[model samples]
Target chain A: MTTPPETTTASTAPAPVLAPPRGTRLTLRDASIGRQGTPVLEGLALDIAPGEILTVVGPSGCGKSTLLRTLAGLLPPLAGEVDRDGIPITGPDAERALIFQDDALLPWRTLRANVELPLAIKGVGRRERRARAEGWLERVGLDGHGARLPHRVSGGQRQRVQLARALAGEPRAVLMDEPFGALDAQTRAGMQQLLAEVLRGTGATVVFVTHDVDEALFLGDRVALLGTGTGRVPHVLDVPRPRDRTAHDDPATVELRRTVLTSLGT
Target chain B: MTVRHLLRLLSLVAALGLWQLLTAFDVSVWLRFEQFPTVVDVAREFGERVGSEAYWQDLTDSLSRIVTGFVLAAVAGVAAGTAIARSRLAADLLGPVLEVLRPIPAIALVPVAILLFPSNEQGIVFITFTAAFFPVMVSTRHAVRALTPVWEEAVRTMGGGRWRVLGSVVLPGALPGILGGLSVGIGVSWICVISAEMISGEYGVGYRTWQDYTVVDYPGVLVGMVTIGALGWLTSTAVEVLGRRVTRWLPRTESRAEAPAPRRSPSWGRSLAGAADPGPLTSTKEA
Candidate 1:
């Protein structure tokens, strides 16, 4: 639970707003990670509810990425626990999908084949995999791009294809590490809008990491402010709804934004 | 001429002219055109052999051996590379050993190879395998290791098993790299195979060259050398063409990874201008 700061919802500045619960999707408890015998991230705890967008905003090299890596099961947690619907965290599973910022699509794969990769790994039938991939591609507005190679697509589109690949498997929750951070401001905005729409339709829980305060407020159901090194607990804030955030209309959300900006240590 | 083309053409011509000049100057009577075969004599021998069924058949036999060795390496290399890549322990244990031995020329291994094998033929084949394996292994390992993590993540997220991931994501992703290795391997295999035969075997271009050497048929020996070089060049080029066909979707950067030149950006000015929404300054934007 985040400590609610002073009221500033009435202020002109943009802030965060929170939507009520659908379900508990992902829960982190005292989870820490280490690499090569040294600790990189320390005790961290948070829970993101279903249909909720939780943005993790933090300083550079703050183990924000490590935390996300632990969640994704790319790296083992050195200490503590992660719970997915009451089950203890284990090896990487289908319910927890992670999207990297760099797109990271295989160079040899076509956009459609890249998306189909996960299903193929699962040994899913070819026809079914194609169908699932095509549906998700349509959802992400990249239909007819199945044959195109990763290098042939624009950076933004490659990321979108990655987004589609993540969603195609129909995971219970999605973990993104600054997915839109690499894109230009305009493309980033369009992606954010696309993500919001996707989130709304699917009702899957999302825990996204980013550096931008505005992006966190605009997209997150709640935002967690992770500090620089030895990242402590987040100063979680609620995100405002109907998110046309350039003109903030509420005092509570505005107050939270100011509080978040301050917590960012600017 | 452009610098690269000129350099290539000049080196080749210079080499031939030097050989001719050396013959004219009679640098060594045994190596001179009087005692040895002039360029024309060897070319004539090659032309005469082209119309002979026995020569054509010998060429096929040698090709079959080289192809067999190359194919074996390809299959084994791809499998081993993926396995090592997926397992840290396997890579740690095997990678260093491979690297240590990879630098030793395959041709140099023929004497030891002959001692290990029962016959000259087996030794030569072993030599061919050794030449092909290292490059194939190196290529495969690189291809597998270089695969982006997102590909595996994508696979696991989609409920893919380890094997599925290997087959679907890792294998295809590594194809371009593997192909590059294979092209080099194919070229090297021929070199070693011919050397192996010349050193000890009873048949093939290598054996034929050694026979010519013993008989003082210097023109025949020159013909043999040219045939071996030409065969190596042809087969490797063919492999490269095949690799390109199989991995059409891979990026130019990755596909041409083995080549030594920096890539120039393709002309996108015309395409950009003709696009539905043209930018003020036209250039191909990497998607």
Candidate 2:
């Protein structure tokens, strides 16, 4: 795959229609991230080509969420740094959106309002924001349920709303901290499929965190197997192109899944 | 009416009947029944007092003082609480001072208020302000502090600054807590206003009650107590109704069967027992 030259500054505009195949390039150079002041994960040297789906899989408490937070600029890096294009990420910016594990739909906002949050924060006009939010809701299969409160929707539907909320802003990079972690197995599969389809041609750089090895392989262009003992991603395996459910049963993917499971000490 | 409303009415009647029975039998063993008025006596006095201009003035005076004080306290308390919870500098500077003052009962401040204010009216208003302020401040602080971090971060990641975050996330997110505080604040304001009026004010239901007691007009005192009780109930109901209207986005857990049951009825019992429960603050989730 041909990767475009890294843009020197953070780009807020949606990717151009006739752009190169790759999305935003996210580079973590000798990065160390942790909760509070202490570092849990260190020496995380990795680069993701723009629009590439990079999934990090590990055991519980392996700091997959922390890595996502660090990249999203929600949490400060304990050491080293994460750069988008060539610009350092010091704090949260609209260019990066984190889809939380708990769905984190504002309890007070309806599904559409929740999805409209980023646009609202950006001062988008009411009519325009509402229309864009409705379009996203429709895109996420929540067309008629925009008026429902976040708590009124099912867990899977809430996650869908969260995805719509994240993507509605047209962020350059999406940081997902196990966005489907709370859903049932069937629902998780459905979400994985939907996310894959929606993100197909956008070329938006994605860093998806998950514990399920099968999910990591099914969705990621590259699966990074993180070790619990050291909190470092020791193995990185590249999957064949057009990664999806069909790719899940590919001989290379099956072999890589076993490698990831073994690395996670399952 | 439903059986619940019937039972509530029955309970009221039973209590009144027991009071009348005590008066009729002149049960003066523990407390003197002769000193207390009968239900009929209180009812007659209520009818006479309700028709009097002086009674109306007293009612209006008590209401105006409590309303003004409560409104001032709600606005100031919410602002202070939000600042304390949201800003580290504000929290450090004002938090400890408020904490020190919070535990001092509003009634206990009556003497201080009397000395501080230029007039007894101002003193009474100050007491009511003190009584309402703490609950509003504390509950708002709790609400603001308890806000999920993701909500703020969600706005921040979307490029929202301090003001935008406050307006869109913090204020609205902490609204249920703020409303909870307002409910408790209004109830406490009545308590302090009545006490302050009884102690120093010239015209108020509380002052009238004390005046009636001094003149041995026992039935008139009961009329004052019932008036205060009804006034407190009406004000608190107004706050709750306003809360419901503003927070319409909140998921209502009320079942069809539970819809007819009044939240205020149980609250009345709780308040009579002296503001024990803080009532519902975060039960906005659909059951």
| DockQ metric for all predictions | 0.25, 0.32
- What part of the reference interface contacts, as a 0 to 1 fraction, does candidate 1 reproduce? 0.39
**lDDT tens digits, residue span A54-94, model 1:** 99998888877777767766677778887665556677777
lDDT of 2 at A167: 90
What DockQ would candidate 1 receive versus the native complex?
Answer: 0.25
RMSD of each: 9.3, 9.2
lDDT of 2 by residue, A20-81 (tens): 43456788889888889878788888888888899998887778888888888888888887
Candidate 2's interface RMSD, please?
Answer: 14.2
Predicted model with the maximum lDDT: 2
Instruction: Show the lowest summed lDDT stretch of 10 residues, model 1 chain A.
Output: A8-17
| lDDT value, candidate 2, whole model | 0.83
Q: Pick the candidate with the highest DockQ.
A: 2
